[model samples]
Target: MENLTFEQLPQAMRLLHEKLDRLEQRFEEQNTLQDAETIFNVTQAAAFLHLSVATLYVKTSRREVPFNKQGKRLYFYKAELDEWVRKGRKKTMSEIREEAGQHVLSTKRRT
Candidate 1:
């Protein structure tokens, strides 16, 4: 780092403050975007989920996917869609084994 004279310190500090303010503003913008819930129509939802529109429609009709309906339109929240996908996740073999062990322990006689 270059040495700064007392006279240059204030100017350097001002520049540093401006850069910090910009960084903070960017961080806040990113947080605002994350805090906003994304709502997607059927087509957009289908694209997000990598499903064909017809297949998405079928799933919605079957009440298999999380969604909201307003009159003739369907709306899906991105967070809810993410959770719905997560709900279908298969347990790893170790997880299944742990669950089975717990079940066995719970059912065992106390004697």
Candidate 2:
């Protein structure tokens, strides 16, 4: 302990502080990236959507939900799911069919 001079202590403290600052910056960057990444596992995706895992699987199978499969694992893109919900918010199959039928009738009258 007595071997080192007083000047060495300040340099050592400065080096330690620099290392700590770098570590803090790295941690913040990783946290930001994690917040940006929307990939979720099946359980996480189900929980996020407030749906059962089985129902999620069924919807995935029906192509109603977008998913990514990497080997045996499945992942959902949160953005795609959000967009899917937005697109489905205001219309049903019957409404769509009725609109198509009206279009057809209007076309026939014009002809």
Candidate 3:
């Protein structure tokens, strides 16, 4: 890197301070708004989950996915949907093998 002269150092520092202040303002603006819970209908929920509405309907009828029934209307909570996706997470093959190894070792110790 080329060395900055004494005169250039103050100007560089001042420019950095201005950029930092702008970034701080943007962050503050983003966080100042209150976040409210969002509800999604079947169409929206299916779109959010990247599935077809028919599939979502089937899943909901089968009680496979998290949902709320209000009269005949179906509702989904955004947070609940996120949790549902998280709960369906599958472990990798290596992870399953490692867990099996641990179980085998524990069982042998008890024998």
Candidate 4:
């Protein structure tokens, strides 16, 4: 310790700081990757979508929602679920009424 000069001490400290920074960066990256790879449980998925667990189960049973089954546990992919919701989005009342009216008119004309 006493044999080391001031210049050597600074170099040693700099190297130590750089090593710690690299370690911290790697840890952060690893944590991010782990988070991305994590799959959500049914409750978590329901909460994420703001829906009830029963509704989630119904959707899963109807094959309207995306899920993954591992042994006894069920998991949902956040991205896939989000995309599915986006694709099968709810329609406005006006659109539904218009379609219903069109159907009724067509049926009446056929009769």
lDDT values of the candidates?
A: 0.92, 0.88, 0.90, 0.88
Give every collision pair in model 1. Answer: none
TM-score of every candidate: 0.65, 0.50, 0.67, 0.48
Q: What residue pairs are clashing in model 3?
A: none
Tens digits of per-residue lDDT for model 1, 1-111: 999999999999999999999999999988767634889999999999999999999999999999999999999988799888989999999999999998888889553
- Candidate 1, residue 10: how far the Cα is off, in Å: 20
Estimate candidate 3's alpha-carbon lDDT, on a 0 to 1 scale.
Answer: 0.90
Off by over 4 Å in 2: 1-36, 91-111
The predicted structure with the larger TM-score, 2 or 3, is 3
List the candidates ranked by lDDT, beginning with the highest: 1, 3, 4, 2
Candidate 4 per-residue lDDT, tens place, 14-103, comes to 988999999999999988777657679999999998999999999888988889988988899776776777998789999999999999
Look at candidate 1 and tell me the lDDT of residue 38.
Answer: 85
> In candidate 3, what are the lDDT values of residues 6-99, reduced to their tens digit?
9999998998899999999988776543211678999999999999999999999999999999999999987788888999999999999999
Candidate 4 runs further than 4 Å off: 1-36, 90-111
Q: Rank order by TM-score, top first? A: 3, 1, 2, 4
Collision count for each candidate, in order: 0, 0, 0, 0
